[model samples]
Target: MSAAEVSVRRRRGSFGRLFASEVHLVFGRRRNQVGLLVLFGLVTMLGVALKVSAMRHPGDRGGDLFSLVAGNGVFLGFAGLTIEIALFLPLAVSVLAGDAVAGEANLGTLRYLLVAPVGRGRLLVVKACALGVGALTGAVLVALAGVLVGVLLFGAGPLITLSGSQIGLGDGLLRLLLAALYVAVGLAALGMIGLFISTLTEQPIAATVATAMVSTLLWILDAVPQLDWLHPWLLVDRWSAFIDLLRDPVFTDRMVTGLWVDIAYGAVFLFAAWLRFRVKDITS
Candidate 1:
């Protein structure tokens, strides 16, 4: 191969190695492993509870699937997603993202890693990819566990929507996956926020708490009765809007808005982090 071709191939290989190393570092820890196990366990418990509840109230199938169990097996994914989007999944992501940089610096590994043959920008990119992978994995695990348990316990059938519309099993499963994707995207933005905070301190725990506290505060502000003006622009304002996908006609305005909001946040925060880390004085 020509020199140019060889250069491109080498770059690709280097990035692949970087990404693999980053993923290993992020998830190889005991705490991260336990966190993932806890997430799956909680979702599993939720599925069992929903199955029992459905059996107890066979004639009480009501409410939208996204917000309630609705006594239907197919809707169980939405039920689990509803809980995860608000807390569990995001918390898992925050723990990883918050430690991406600060944890390495605290352990006195950041300086050594920088001494390797990788650029700072590329290092940040690999870290972001690792965080995204973790967030997406957490999301898919909840959905998959919910679906598996939901089908086994309650049995799968047509999905009933909020508008009293029935969706076929195939289409229902597809929509469920889309809803999970939406949750993953929203959590990715939160991961960026954690990454940004990680750049500001050497204490991973502090960064994690700060990220979670900021997210909780945003949720609180979104709920205030008089924060109407800020509601439209808040990061968590449209997280649950993924439920619109379940509509017969598919109301996508909110989902579209939510995606753009996530994109904007991801861009702004990731850039800020890169800028900070690029000039940071690593004394550790």
Candidate 2:
């Protein structure tokens, strides 16, 4: 290969290695591991609780989509995702995204990393990719854990849709995976916001809390009936759109709108993060 070709290949190799290192650093931390465990544990508990409730009251189906869990184990994944998207998933994304840069700065290692050949923009890209992966991982873990526990306790089979129709086991699982991915996309948007926040502070904890609080605030605003006009603009407003995936015909309107909103938020914040980090003075 020519020198130009060789240089391009080397750059690609370096980027891949850097991305792998960042992913490893994110998941390798004890706190992140505990956070993932907590996510899994919560889903498992939800499954067990539903199983007990079903035994005590054969007619009770819990409530909402959760009610369907009594009939099919697959709904447990949906139920778990619903509960997680409300708060836990955002918090998990915040922890990773919020710490993406602040954590390195806090440890006095960011400067050392910057001293390498990688540009700041490339580093930020790697960090964003790692955060996205981490967010997706957490979402998938909850869905998988819910499915495993639900199947073990209740048993899996055809899923009953909200439209009062049924889908085969394979289709149901496919929808479940789609739902997990949808939720992850929303979480990834949240991560972008966290990434921007991380660029503003060296304290990872503060950035984490701030990023989480932003989600909490959006959720609170979304709950207000008078704010119906503003609901469409809120980031957390359409997070529950994943439920549409469980429908028989599979509603895509809300999911499509949600995807657009997520993309908008992600792109805006990601650009803002890049802009801020580009001029950010690394003191550590």
lDDT of 2 by residue, 50-139 (tens): 888889899865447877888888888999999989889999999997779998899899999999999999999999999899989999
lDDT of 2 at 209: 98
Please estimate how well model 1 matches the true structure, expressed as its whole-model Cα lDDT: 0.84
After superposition, the stretches of candidate 2 with alpha carbons farther than 4 Å from their true spots are none
The Cα local distance difference test for each model comes to 0.84, 0.92
lDDT of 2 at 274: 99
Relative to the true structure, candidate 1 reaches a TM of 0.94
Which has the greatest TM-score?
A: 2
Model 1 — which ten-residue stretch has the worst lDDT? 62-71
Model 2 scores a C-alpha lDDT of: 0.92
Estimate the TM-score for candidate 2.
0.98
Model 1 residue 6 CA deviation in Å: 2.5
